[model samples]
Target: MVTRDSAWPGGVPCWVDLGVDDLDRARAFYGELLGWEAPPGSPETGGYSICLKNGRAVAGIGPKQGPPDVPPAWTTYLSVADADETARKISAAGGKLLVEPGDVMDAGRLAIAADPGGAVFGIWQSRAHTGIGLANEPGALCWNENMSRDYEANLAFYRSVFGYDYDDMSANGFRYSVFKVDGNPAGGIGELGADFPADIPPHWMAYFAVADTDAAVAKVTELGGGVLRTPWDTPYGRMAILGDSQGAVFAVIAMPAGG
Candidate 1:
């Protein structure tokens, strides 16, 4: 399992959080569904509950800020050495800053941006909080992927901003590439196939690891969540796409034993 006590390398997907209308309900739902514990955070921390798995921080759940129109969804955050500098590079790379770089108390600085393909993601400059404490294991994040209609444009934007190297891994009929940071896989970029539904927007999707994808999906439905896609086997793992009761979609994968 991948565990860390220090800040992640810049350009790596370091964290993910869910912005929801009801924090209590979200905490309870995820706790039951994923075996997470999300006690109320201290007032000084803006009551941002850190989702814990076996007593280790895995993700976050917090109140949704901004206008009421802001949708409840899971946001993937990339690590950066300097949020302000990254913000400038993002705009220069043809991306728009949805939320300009700003300090999150003293924990870190962060900014949200949209790529040329219109997929929204965040950049985090860690200070007090170094993001996920455990990963690549059941009940924690394992992968993040950008599903885009314009893969080339999105890839170019990220490469320009994060200086990422990619390895083309397209096979069969799927077009996919693995984004690497210092020779280690950090994330993925996938082209939305023509068979993809028109209603689905381009976005960053977070995947959590599980021991049993089929069982996890069943528990999701049992807890009032919906199944976006049924369990299917991939070359990498058995996986399923699911949505919380609030309609925020995410994926869960049961990686082949050693993965």
Candidate 2:
């Protein structure tokens, strides 16, 4: 029953591309820390390098571009069935339309969008590219979270677009508003405060899995990524935030033993 209803091409995530301020520096830093092998790109692939873990595509690397408004950061692209229709629902749901749906030729449709709180993300309608090939793998994206001021709008927009459901239920003193994709447990959506710790913006924060939180936090400093959070516990696992060598912000979660 391979129906088009549940169809998400390339994969659900295909991969995440980091708009790095310095590709050479990021290559060196992440290379040492994550043990990724990034080979040179060709004309067909543009300048983006495909990062491999144990010789498989884990993520991608590309130089940052755009106006002064562009910050060096990682943007998450979620797989959807129809990107144009999803973009329409974004505006109708009170979210901002950042980029209109455009064709990646035969690759599929894509559009950039922001939630009610102005956190930017991309919607990928995969014709050829599905999503990320590897998730929950070391150095790859483990999870993505939307920290927002308006949880209702955030939940509504995503629910309309990807047909996701929110738990909105708390457990063990930690609020776990889990995001589900087509009824499967996905990641999360958390509340954002104005005076939040460490100057975090209302944005989608990606989590990369690491073997050790303490060691990874230490190596973040050694590799030139700045730490925002020390190791902390949750129902999921231990996690921390750090800026990559190129100054793009992201986080890493160290899974607990026997979980």
Candidate 3:
């Protein structure tokens, strides 16, 4: 059983979803690269496909159902007590709501919101579907981040919504904002306002933990995926930027063993 942490809102993040350009191609690449599989769904849930690892739900793969210009990327969702209440808190904290609380068949009720700094994530209320059944595996999502524009606004916004505390860590020559719920690490945030052009959009990026970054990069390429950035050593671990066969970009990190 996964260790229960009282600091986290819902015993750590269960899963994440990606808005991909082409769901079919994304499925193919991930299946080939990670040995993961997914089955198509019913209209009751927008025909979503739950990505699985070792025959258990790990994440999700879906089409770019939002605006046309929105880039295809992976998004992480946090389990919340009530998505409606969380939406209210988000707005009161200076964040904007993209989608109001709505039920997707029996999958669950969910709402999308952006942080005060413009990073987006989902608040989910589970019913029949609790969450991803597996995580932190080689083929499953492992880490999450918000590349935001305003650091102070982001901090204030999340504190009001989730009651989180954070500490700044100077790692790899860049100041990294590490997220903690109550006291345990939840994720990290990075400042990308000036680093990225105005035309570039701000969004949350999910990271998949791989057994070996080098092997994953090579395998991704072999499966028709792209490597936006080559493998490099970060203070936390070795990582590389990878894209699925459908041009949906994400990341893979290999942490040092025995941490």
Candidate 4:
């Protein structure tokens, strides 16, 4: 199990949260599926629900504040030493700034941005809230990946903005790269497969750690959520893609011991 007691390093994926249409339903579904207990959110923080596992912060669920047409999705947030400086670098690297750097009360400062390939993500400068308290453990985040049509362009944007180093893992016609921070896996980038519909834009997908992939997928189905892919084994672990009851997509994996 990987546990954290302090802020993450710059450019590391330190947090993730779902922006859902119905906060109550999201809380219920995730609470049942991931064994999380969400305490009452303080109004001072806009009623954002923080999901906790074993008394530690795991993730968040909040009401979607985007346009009415926007669908619920998970946003991956990377840690930064300076939110304002990272926002500037995002613009200079050909990305569009969605929300300017702003403080979330005294919790931290954040900004939303999209890569040139249209993958939206967030940058966080931690203050009182230092992001996820437990990760790489059951019911917590394990991996985050971005799928884009123009993989090279998006790769260049991230490298330019964060000075990220990647380990190319492309093989057998599949283009994939794992970005690392200080020798630890930060996230992944891959070219959207040919099977992906053209209308689907580039996006980031978060993966939660589970003790049993097949069992988790079963629970997802039993809860009225559909499984996008049956559990399958990969070199890294066993994984399955799935969508929540509201169609918010995510993945779950059971990593090999110590992997």
- What TM-score does each of the candidates earn? 0.97, 0.87, 0.89, 0.97
Give all candidates' CA lDDT scores.
Answer: 0.92, 0.73, 0.75, 0.91
lDDT of 4 by residue, 98-170 (tens): 9999999888999999999899999999999899999889899999998999899988999998888999999
Compute the lDDT of residue 124 as modeled in candidate 1: 99
Taking the tens digit of each residue's C-alpha lDDT, what string does model 1 give over 137-164?
9999999999989889988999999999
Query: What TM-score would candidate 3 get against the native?
Result: 0.89
Model 1: colliding residue pairs: none
Candidate that scores best on lDDT: 1
For model 1, the local distance difference test gives 0.92
lDDT of 2 by residue, 75-118 (tens): 88877777888888888877787778999657668888888767
Return the clash pairs for model 4, or none.
Answer: none
All predictions: root-mean-square deviation over Cα?
1.1, 3.8, 2.8, 1.1
Clashing pairs for model 3 are: none
Off by over 4 Å in 1: 44-46
